[model samples]
Target: MSQFSLSNDNDDSGRLKIHLNSCYLHVKVTRPYIIITMGDQIYQTSISEYPDGRWNEGFEFSVSYHAQLFDTIQLDVYDSYMILPDRHVGRAEIRLIQLQDMPATFTSFYEVWDKKLSTGASSHAVRKTTMATNVGALQATISYRFLHIGDPQQQQQQLQQHDLDRQPMEDDLIFRKHLQQNRDTADILFHKYEEGSHANMDQLHLGTQGHTESRTTSSSSANTMLGSLGSWFGKGTASTSLGHPTDPTTDDLPTDILNDIDSSLKTYPLLDTLGSWTVSKETNQILRAIGKLLAAFGQGFELSNLQMLSGFAVVERFYQELPREQRTWDVVRDLSEIQVASHLWRYSMASYGWKGLNFIGKGNGYLSDAIRHHSDSKSVMEHLSLPPDDLLAYEFRNSGAFRPSYFVAHDPSTHSIVLSIRGTMVRPKLIAYCNRHSIGALYIVGHSLGAATASLLTIMLLDYMDELQKGQSLPFTLQCFGYAPACCVSLDLAEKYKDHIQSIVFADDVVSKLCYGTMMDLKQMIIAGAEAAQNLGISQFLWTGAAGKEKWKSAFEQVAECRQRCIDSMENPRLYVAGKVYQFWLDPTPKNPTRIVVERTSPKRVSSELILKTSIIMDHLPTNFDIAFRRATESMMTEPREQQDGVLDQEDESRTAEQELKHTSKRGGTDGSPMIDEQYTR
Candidate 1:
């Protein structure tokens, strides 16, 4: 029998089998799982808890004789964590043919490999450490026993376990490679941004060849949250910088925070049972109606104060009006502390997309200078040609672990991508209140820009916990649902925290597709900008009239030129809708008036054609999405079958004359196309 042995070597060890061609075998870690390919066979391990130091007992698995002929083995060790990206700890290569003949048993075959940061670097420099040292090492011992082809009993046993072995199927291989590439690309881009920012900071410090000084100078203590000598990961006193990893600080966490987070991570299959039938029809109808009110509430945020509920009062009244048995959810908080920092830009001279708002730090709110150090994001206002007043007030005072990207704003320069200044002020108060009084899960919901802000805050909180807890997973559970959200994240960040985000999209929602200009062709970008300018009205400005008209005209021209320049430079901005997406579509055919469909889609599948018939403004509103959502959910009650194509075959449609006509070869689907639409062309 051929005996192939694999072992952890250490708590973080992994093995890779090389082919005769000298190509290094590949293996990747996705949190609790590890995927490895040996010879032509791929093996996947069962999900297990993160390992502690040294489980030295070697592992045994079946391998073919041809695999044994392969002469090399590469072992890579990684430190996998939930919140942070996995770190490569160590790697080693062993030439098995040189050790001894494969058939012989060898116990003395061993090697110690030092952990490395990069391929050429010999020093074991950790993320924060400047000097190299023996930070970590791995000692591996491997043995192989070759078996004869005539060992029928051994072959039979191996055959029995074949089903348990997870060979990397075609789809899995493609998807895993894609995810890896996306991650790598994101890392490269972020590092580039960091490098560029550092260069700019140096120039600013040097006064541009001694010709200029900094724009402003303040005490270093003014930016207290910004890194100083004592910041985490910064060089400073070890006692203050490195807290005990086992116990997180209690100052920032709720007493039951750990328990809450742990419980939320556990599976809840009951959620799968939710449908119109699960609750009273009346209750579903009430919720459907409330969806419209909620949309109105979100839209009103730009014009109204946080204290005003707008349509929410109507929603609360409707909930109270529901029959006792039909009340599915008890009204907990009508408008909790879910404050929205409204964003507005001058789309045209005649009118703004949304009206004027106060600029932060000038009789409005405070904006920090910390984000300014990340030079890549400095062009936010210039790219859009937006006035300073248009900038959101949110500022992260501390050095962030993550580089800013599409999640907050369009430009990759120094911009606040997280909470608005108002949100920055209100968030802590809300979080503190939740920790003190939260009896159950914290539910956050937002629409449009509010959705983007909500998503940002959720991650921000997680990072905060990661710091206080020293990598311990937070205890309490929090969930966010964003409706009609614009593109606000890179694919890597999306995949990194896929479990925590969900978005609702209406058919062809224009708002959801906003940030792709950086990814789209220049023609598309120009068209988008023109459309925004036209629809929002460039003449809305007071200076557009005869008084100061010449100056305003020149300013508008410059804005257009700057916009085109920005688009030219943005070759392939990292942007995408992160996490699960629920897409809704309305039936286009007249005969199927009531037919609406909702399909669960990945970020890659979101398309602009779904709502192609509606105006851009109408396509993006939550009010329209709510109507379609209700209709789709109602249709699900009678029709439960999914079509060969993705669209659900609703019972009402299946029972109709239109369905019969569409099923025939002569007349199938609109424009004689297939019933289901084409996938988004990424």
Candidate 2:
């Protein structure tokens, strides 16, 4: 149970109001047709004549359930158009935990953005793409109150014995009136102390304390006193603490694991490329390299969905074809998308890593690619069941996937609607594989959707291992790399994994930021249909382009028109892409063609600009990362080096490092410009 006061200090209060009861959400929009929604619940106002700046007063809101579990709450404002689709004016997104710090009733200002369209005329055709820009401002005083139901049966018993209805009766109202009077008296006494001399401060405190005690004793109702008292006394105490945990005093590395990683490096010299990827700490280099390799498996699947059908055969072939220096990695198991409930989700079990010292100097084992392929026939979801109540607390359950138990910083957060059902089947298999292989350290890399799955797997895997070891320090370590991964966990979970996870983002990659803090709804189906219709045009254009024919030119035009319409209508859902992101931005001005700025720090605010200036799809391709890395390093592909186990001859690419640092430091620059020169060493 909680209360939120949404207000602006500069404006008049009491114009805007909001309330939540049980699972129901209620909203009141004042100027224009303001619609507010959470999940499937929505409340909208009719078209109004009030000009954009006419209102000064605000509103209030209240909810009855435990609102702390929500990761983000967004309020959208729209302007109704007579003939065209509604224009999205702006939005306000607030994390629930952030609101708990303010006074019970407080005012906050929210900025509004106007949709701007960028268009072009190509000789004979016009193209339009819409983007959002911060424009207007709205000031409103908003507040919410939640009624906590602690032990429903006990509450019912108390209510029945008191002969009281749920609503406030005359006696309850009288008691509340006295409580308020006493509170006001305390406030006056406290203020008097501030105005008076220091000699009277102690006297004022004693008087205020006595007044509060008297009020509490007089109004103590066994049935309702606890709730009111808790409210008055528990401000700020119930909220989750802000910010991340303190950094580890020492690196969580062991002697044996370091030796194993060193052995892998010695056997596979290409592993030395890891020194090029930098984090703040030197000990983290091994995990970063492992992440890059795991990311390759995810990128491998993107090569062709057909490869997924081949399963183990394709995995073996993929590894076998790699250069000798890169072939030391092995596929512990291959995961595949599977059916969960009624949806086919992507929770496959593929993890590629070094198999430790026993396999040193020996090639990784591979099953023949020519072996007959056998598809899994059993229903994967059939045996997947939820754990008992005791284990459920650690589990993460979303509209798409579920696990028995796992460590989580927060629950009931938004997950990508496209998340695969395969996650439900992969956890146990991953645990089993790790047990059998005697993995000293586990590292996973996932790109886009695979990144999301990897995140869930990391949490669940740790919890499973912890449970199995009975709180003892396990023999292995776990880390993950998310290359442009979607937001898979709640804000709390993201923060919890901050030290162990690295989410890499390329400049203006729409896929990484597309669904960060948003949810998909049935209403999106309409837009999905529109998007599908546009895809037909795109498909036709692709076919015609492939044939080197002018045929389907009209289809290409229609595709552009459809894209413009969707942008104008705001049909595309903007989901919040979460992670402790590290962005790589292309130099806005290619003055130094060799340099691509790197932002070592995470972004403070997510940019709402989703429109792509170049190829809309190419920004998300795995190859784009290669191009960025090339520009960043200003180096060509390195020739394959001869491999000799236990015979090391290498030098740090110190010259390349020196060249990268020659440019100006631009950390925290805007518009995807150079942020910083990457500088660190292993």
Candidate 3:
């Protein structure tokens, strides 16, 4: 009719409709599930087993279509889902078709996300190789391809160190970029010290080129991670999954999501009479989560390590693999800049403009809790996705596969685990994929782009305590943590996220360095000496509490001295590294600006560097037992405690610093606001 046919529009199923657009769609799709709910990208779900029941059913799905004023549009609904009434069980079959003349946007999504991507492979794959490239004016251009590994051990060590090294450098880049993203967010917490934040705040006035990080000899961790490589892309036997898709512009959304909603479970709250829905569902959810934890426990099922409980096998894996030397370069290798940035932007708790279109007032942890919350609520399953028009099903509980964020659920029993982590900036749409696949034990960890997502989500989670206390929502019980990350939030935000996130801080790592200066002006400190250690900007860099700093300092010192004495220490961070990161904060100010001052009654038996290093290296706590590190140290070693009474504790000192910061904020943020550093300003 009207030269438009809905009959052969898609596949044999009556669900397909033809879109009129010019598209060069040559895609080889092995992946069959059409992910219709998340953002624009579609991901291949990794499952441990196939589902006994339909994955999607009774789930309502929809798509927005604009037909010319009087033009007509057809809605085809095929394959259906079936939910077993009153049993907390369901089944689904999605009838999908090969994509052709797909909307330009859909085709682009296909190229980046589907199994069939550029050249041949689906650009959407983590193992995709021979992908297309888009080098914008941004330096994110790929210069190198792959690095050869003589041995796996060497490569693994390189990978871990590589992550560590690039972590700081990349953080610096993001912080700088953050400075440009709406100046309003740059509000200096210089007074940050006033509100429980202490012992840090320093900056490099624009054009101030006083020092440079002397390409610290070859022994640096950054150097170890890098090995000896400077290029656009780091290729280490690039088989495929090119890491992250370069662009979603050419990606395709799987067409499988256009199936019919099951007839039985049409009501909201999803199920009519879920057998013992109250107890079984709750028990099963915990069970499934615990199984995942056991997966994380692996051999550690017997170990009582609290850190290991988090399922860090991936970190162990990263620490186990990767080239070390190339990590020193300015740009760290990634799946794709846009995907990473987009994901970061999309999930940013403080996203701006059109980027966070659907996230209106949504907190970061939405994805993490979406499934569980929906299961417990009247989730009719919103049919809208990115372009905000499409439906798949009205699921009782959306699969973890539908989620674009990361997740890790643990089954406290048996210590089994399941982790769902999206690679790179794409945020891989984990929920839907997790649903399609049986995640034995789920554990998820993401960085940079992933890190920010995690941070924002966690912050919002703690913030949701109000809802939980009011009984509006079930208390989100997933144990989650973020490390060396940035948040689209601040310390004051803690009240909101009090119950949700645990953050890890690495000493001297400038992860959150860009948030402050004069009063939140990001100067970019664009200058020659900007990279040098002598101009350390610790005041603005250290986000971890001073107790954290002190703890790290003590552990590092023990480890450093242990290693120097040729003592065996597996956890000790390399010494040259401790000094480099610590020294990175050289008193740039004329008067010990941002200096982590030290006091001791014992005549300073141990160097502050060693003190800090051992604390981190040995990973000890309650350093008060040792004079060199504790409050009693001053009286025991170099000077008497009474003699150094003027030297305030970390907290006391922070209070004093804030009294000075108020006068500073009046001046302004970064370059435009002031000409001199705070040491000079104060």
RMSD to true structure for each model, in Å: 28.2, 27.1, 29.8
Model 3 agreement with the true structure over 436-531: per-residue lDDT tens digits: 223222222333334445545443333323322232133323333333333334333433443344332222223322221200011111110122
Between candidates 1 and 2, which one is better according to lDDT?
Answer: 1
Q: Model 2 lDDT vs. the true structure?
A: 0.34
Best by TM-score: 2
Candidate 3 matches the true fold with a TM-score of 0.20
Tell me the TM-score of each prediction against the true structure. Answer: 0.28, 0.30, 0.20
Model 2 RMSD in Å is 27.1
User: What C-alpha lDDT, on a 0 to 100 scale, does residue 604 get in candidate 3?
Assistant: 10
Question: What tens-digit string does per-residue lDDT give for candidate 2 at 588-616?
Answer: 22234234433443422332223322332
**lDDT per residue as tens, model 1, 189-233:** 111112212122211111113211124345423343243222323
The lDDT leader among the candidates is 1
lDDT of 3 at 485: 38
